[model samples]
Target: MATALVTGGAGYVGTHTCVALMEAGWEVAVLDSLENSSSAAIDAVAEVVGRGLRLYVGDCRDNSAVERALTEAGPDAVLHFAGLKSVPDSVADPVRYYRHNLESTSVLLEAMARHGVRRIAFSSSAAVYGLCKELPVSETAATRPANPYGWTKLISEQMISDVVRSDPRWSASLLRYFNPVGAHPSGIIGEDPEGAPANLMPYLLQVAVGRRAELPLYGTDYPTPDGTALRDYIHVMDLAEGHRAALEALVSSAGQVHTYNLGTGRASSVRQVVAALREATGHPLPCREFKRRAGDVAELWADPRKALLELGWSADRTLAEMCRDAWAWQSAHPQGYRR
Candidate 1:
């Protein structure tokens, strides 16, 4: 059986990807700090996949902890997802973003080098391609990050590329993600951001579930159809499957750093999202307008043809399904894992 050690596996994407990997017959071990995430997610993953998980509760930046996890898990590859992910938070505190995101990656690479784990699948972001001049951005677009968060992801991608280029034996997949939202269809595991939610989908879920009074609609005067910023939101489950596909490709192949944009090639406005969630929950989903925040672009989606061609992976979920599943999880676990 193939073994994989998932850093931040207790997180939203991490937990869902654990379900995908386990279902695909891979033994999964999780290393998490449980600082911005919860252990309950692991339990939910176990419930969904009908398998127990091996987890190490520690930050990824800790070299000893990572080394120990690597030694015990005996992974074929490492899925690096341990990083602070709030764009606004990163903008407000670039130092924290830089220290945590970069250092964690650096330490994980060092540990991987020590343990001879040559294959790595990095969790990257579309923020790296900031202020995209083109509508459907491809993988080859210029990476000029508008914010510290984007710079971190772009720089990390470069770091991974450099390492892989230095040693041709090292192989890695940098999956540059668009906005990942929604929950698993089982509704057992879903996104539960610590403190205030940053993304539009989570904020909508919170408002519908009474966690918040209303959504704070940012940037209502953009060039998009509805004036709000446009984003390419893919269902989290589809993204999990993409991760599985990427891992399988790595297993069958070798000696190259593969980068692919993981996103649905469709853009949705904030108002459209509000409408979809309203249908999902039968709530008014009130909203208040706010000025555009830093580190945000007017509109951008993905040219997902590369992923579809190479990995044979394309997101097939609709906006309605995304909202329905997300509402299912949030309504069932209103206080998140606390319930």
Candidate 2:
């Protein structure tokens, strides 16, 4: 088994990816600061693997810390998932967002360069394609990020591209993820957003769990079938599997920077998602229409053909499966790891 270093492996996506890597027989080492995440996430990840994982409590911004972690982990490849990801919060505090998201990556890249870690898989977001004219977005779509958070991710992608191009020895994979929802089938660990949930699934889950009174339906006047915003909601497990496939590609590639869109190549409207959640949870979620969010887009999904064709990766989970798993986790842990 090859050793893989996972930065921010205690995060929602990172924790799931760590478990996926371990399940695939990879020796995983996690470097996390426990800022936005809790150490309990690592425990949940270990529970998924039925054993312990190599975890180091550290931040990605500290070059020395990153250097020590990578050196000690002796990773053949690195997965970068450490960064702040909140659109409204980023809008309120742009500099903080830029500093954390960009600076952390710069530090991680420098550490990887110094430690001779040649391969990397970056966790990017579909937010990079803000207000796209295309329905199902491709990797080559015009990337005009609507919010500061999206811009930071785009800048990070450019940075990775530049670094990889400057050195042929560095092979990188930039995975632009669509909306990631749901949880593991075991319902042990799942999306646990702090404060009010910004994403739809988590917000809806909170409502279903009776934490929130009702779902504030944002923007019910879009040009979609349900006249609400539409997006591609991929299961987190599928996203984890896609990361595994991407890591395989990064290792097998000819030392070139590659980018892929991680999605299910399908779109679901806000109302559609609510309906699916209601069906999955057997709860009629109360929702009220509200004004559109400032940076909300009408419709945004992904054209994941590149991943399917190149990496042999395709999302096998359905929307019903996503809602079911998410509801299961929410029902099991209403407080989300606090209990």
Candidate 3:
């Protein structure tokens, strides 16, 4: 019925969301650069859905590529998930992060406007909250990004919001995702981070699968009960379902921007996560605590009530489920998509 053009459809979140969208009865087309992602993820998506998705292997920042995808797909909406997403890497290379993240959104939004594709669900991050003032961060919390990565995401959110305001044709949802863990549950399609996995769940999965020696605890001296940094880790599939809900909402509304926090609204410390994974994977999941990382916070979760009350979506997967599903994919393909 409706076609959706997904940027970065081969990426960890994008791939899973593609499956969710397809299952929800949307014809999906992908435009990806495959910079840090693999084409095999798309193939896995096809396998999971039992159908082929048209893919444009190109960068979202390229106007020509964006136009080509928009013109050809004739999508009813665009799900933008293409960007460089690493905090340390962004700190090291602010210019690259700003250029890549900002340019891609600007270019894509311009192209979408040109083609009259007005509906978009953007993959924003919790990093936009920077150092949170409140315990359970809500969508209304103040945003003061501590690094370039977070700044880029915040700016992109504003850009989309501005577009929706400027043109009555555009309706948008900016989903500020917390830690997205777990796989598709099928173990067929999952997160496949390149080089070294940056986040917690993937790294733990690698450790369980024998890729890493141990899960290096980033900070264990925090003020939390477990003396470790805390996060709101949501399942990837639930995050996908959140996107589905947001997109469906946007389709029926116009001339507005809705921002939601896609998280479980509960914080889990690193020690707790490691213990859960140990039970799920049958690995000791040993860890060595390190000094607190710079810019590290004690805890940051979500006040996800707005999303539940508005979009009827909330993360339903538990920590054990996250570990189990993540281990399933990582164990099946230890080398990520390269396998």
The global C-alpha lDDT for each of the candidates, from Candidate 1 onward, is 0.92, 0.90, 0.92
Question: What is the per-residue lDDT of model 3 for residues 1-339, given as tens digits with 9 covering 90 to 100?
Answer: 989999999999999999999999999999999998888889999999999999899999899999999999999999999999999999999999999999999999988888889999999999999999787898889999999999999999999999899998799999999999999888988888877888888888888888899877887778889799889999999999999999999988899899999999988999899899888889988788788888988999999999999998889899889988988887788888876
Query: Candidate 1's residue-wise lDDT over 1-339, tens digit each?
Result: 999999999999999999999999999999999997888899899999998999899988999999899999999999999998888788899999999999999999989988899899999999888888987999999888888898999889989889888887789999999999999988999999888887889888889888899888878999888899888999999999999999889875567989999999999998999999999999999999999986578889999999999999999999999999999999999889865
lDDT of 3 at 45: 96
Compared to the true structure, candidate 2 yields what TM-score?
A: 0.98
Q: Which RMSD does model 3 reach against the true structure?
A: 0.9
Candidate 2: residue 210 Cα off by (Å): 1.5
lDDT (tens digit, per residue) of candidate 2 on 79-175: 9999999998999999999999999999999888888888999999998998898867998899999999999999999999998888988888999
Error of 3 at 250 (Å): 0.7
The worst-scoring run of ten residues by lDDT in candidate 1 lies at 247-256
Q: What are the clashing pairs of model 3?
A: none
User: Global CA lDDT of candidate 2, please?
Assistant: 0.90
Per-residue error for 105 in candidate 3, Å, reads 0.5
